[model samples]
Target: MTQTANRFHRWFAEPGPRPPLGTWLMSAAPSTAEAMGHCGFDFLVVDMEHVPIGVPETASILRAIAGTPAEPLIRLAWNDQVLVKRVMDAGGKTLMFPFIQTAEEARAAVSYTRYPPQGVRGVAAVHRGSQFGRAPDYLKTANDQVCVILQLETPEAVERLDEIAATPGVDALFLGPGDLSASMGRIGEIAHPEVQGLIAHAARAAARAGKPIGIVGPNPEMVGGFLGMGYTFAAVASDMAMMTGRAVEWLAALQGRVQAAEPAAAY
Candidate 1:
């Protein structure tokens, strides 16, 4: 079996001049995954945190991204060993953990992705990640090949940001705007002065520790700030947001046409 370099890992190892762009898929559908991939995104994060996607369904999404250039990643609901192993085995190269608040949590998240000496991920060659029972030596090199990204979403996480960034094997740190804002007692105020300062500090801490920072910002203005702050990886928006925004736009235009036609019909 030929060895293939994981793009997710490459992004961290050498995140050149410009940070790579990504999008989120929370609907857990293969069609969305294929569309996001074909749309020229560098990566697409299959969000399982709030999505009702099971392991098998996630595998289906990964399969849809198989022939595309976009990298496949997933934000597991929690940092459990089973979920981490299952998603990775299903071909998710980058695994993002949510609500990580300490260095130990970061370590555990990263360790779960490795095997033995490095981590506790069970060895399984009978999965699609190993080429569907083809590459029998996946366990031997997978530990070093996978990317582990931990999220800093709470005030506690920001307080311990340095320690988390210093954790070995932690490839990147993701900033969760909504959760972090809520945690800071400023619900829905992701753009608040205090929230912005914390985010900036977290990004700097990650950079100082030699790790990349990632974030989920949809609006161009917000995303631009994250990129300008030197976040190496960031998501533009989510699948659900895209659908809702377009639907609203389409419906408003359709309603206007219908109303205009009603006035003309009286003549």
Candidate 2:
């Protein structure tokens, strides 16, 4: 279908309250994507990075999300160009590039979504992004329209955070807490004071550089705090986390003094 306005893109550029809130979709199920889309989230991430979702499935999720107000964003498994091209061709409007540790990597990720002369994305006028060739003006607009957000999860990345945020064509920066904690040797202790300090530092650096930065948390409290600390956007929780959490919560209410189910292994 032809997209007339870039709502998500404008959300960032517009002066507003906290930049939108979002959540991770690792379910790979179109039903889940559609359900979450209708839940009023400002955006929904179709996660291919940790989820076992392939290109075709991603397209399905995109279609499902397209039916609602939530803007669909895809997190690529790596900083690979082919994956970038395929995701864009499938009509993913925004891409979240993971584990980007340097400025060069940040630039490369943006380049993958653009055409040559501006960037290196291969042109495909007949792809879904062009509504299968129905939208003749797609080629002229796609380059300026696709949004890019890079994930910085390591201390090395935070150390050079300013440079990475300054990279040309990079729209926003996202902190991956799970990986950042690991990089800090805290290994899942995201709340440990040391990790918190580094995270706060990165947030301030990004703010000074005048870029909207965001983070994903396993819970609302943590993500809420990040927004308080000056993050522009955040994904407060994941589909899996909310599903299992509510199941356990309701079960405990029924069975007095019952224990919550064993936690799933962290991905």
Candidate 3:
């Protein structure tokens, strides 16, 4: 098997007709993941941060996404070297590290994805990343194929956006509004003026650093706002959130308590 370039990285390197739109996969079910992959999303984030997914389950999810047009982006639970090595060995080419606060932390995250001399990733000759040792050039080419997206979840992290984006091997930046809100003493109020200002500031900072930035919103309207602010990519809610929100809407309509609202534009 010949090694291929990471589609996530290539997608940003070469601009598409429109920015890629994606959704979160918090279900932790391969069947659910495969089903969502066929829904025409540009990518599906296999979230290991808040979900109960482990290395083995993450590998299974990656396999499920292989047959779809969407690329799989693994969001690590934390910025740990062991976890990074395990996921990369399990065939995760694109990774999102959460809660990166400093340029050093961003550099550390990048190093974890690289092999010796370039990084400290432990070697494994016969793992899924190397196609079970069938791909002769996997080791040599893996570093370039790995796309590292670091998440900035607080004001402190956003303050170092330029330094973080300048770090070699960091491919993209993500702003986590939920945590940012909490850190600002306004839990559950992502729409607060202060939070919005910070998010917009981060977007400008990312553009200045010449790095692609991404964000996730609870609905299409919010995501659209982020896109207007020059976010290169954005995810609109999660599988569970969409499912539950629709269920509640239908329940309300069936009982005649309220009329069903017009469907919001996707993407």
Candidate 4:
């Protein structure tokens, strides 16, 4: 079979002058995914970690994003091999494994994305990932197209960034501010100076390891700060966050509590 380009992998392998920006999709709605795809994001992450997006729903979401220029990334709930194989067969190319704390866990996450002598991903003769058996040479080429992104969500994880980044098949690194803050005993305080300090340190560590790093924040301002700290990619909030934030703002305006401001552009 012919090889398909994995843009997420290519973007990090040889980054452009501008860092690619993305957003999270927690609604698990195909329409929402399609709409976000058209909004000019470099990539869109279909969140399976926090949201109830099963394999079938994930397949539908992939179809929704296929027509747009944006790349689709799947954030798995955990570093489970079974979960990884299922989502990959459902057409997930770029996957983000969450809460990884050690080099061994990082290696396991990468192995889940590969098949045969390289790694152990269960094989299937017919599946969406193989174009339903149409891609005769998919087995040989899929490994090259798969992108593995490991999430460092705790102080321990951040401290081991160098070793984890050194693991083969780890295409990129993502620092989860929410979980990291909580792990640092600063829950709901991602902007706390201590948490922010570790974030900056992780970025520099990733740069030193010669790996591209990514992060997500609750707003553009915070994400902009991450970009300035040497993050190669960043995601600003999610569809649900933006929608609810606007809803609250408009309701406050209607109640005369405050004036509603113009909608901020979603990166």
TM-score versus the correct structure, for each prediction: 0.95, 0.94, 0.94, 0.94
In candidate 3, which residue pairs clash?
Answer: none
Candidate 3, 240: how far from true, in Å?
A: 0.5
RMSD of each: 1.5, 5.8, 5.7, 5.6
For model 3, how does the per-residue alpha-carbon lDDT over 224-252 read when each residue is reduced to its tens digit? Answer: 99999999999999999988999998987
Query: Mind giving the per-residue lDDT tens digits that candidate 1 earns over 176-249?
Result: 98899998899989899999998888888888878888898977789999888878888988878988999999
Q: How large an RMSD does model 2 have?
A: 5.8
Q: RMSD of candidate 1 to the true fold?
A: 1.5
Q: What's the CA error at residue 57 for candidate 3, in Å? A: 0.7
Q: Candidate 3, 125: how far from true, in Å?
A: 0.6
**Residue pairs whose backbone atoms clash in candidate 2:** none
**lDDT score, candidate 1, position 76:** 92
lDDT tens readout by residue for model 4, 144-186: 9899999999999998999999999999999999999999899
User: Any runs in candidate 3 off by more than 4 Å, and if so which?
Assistant: 257-267
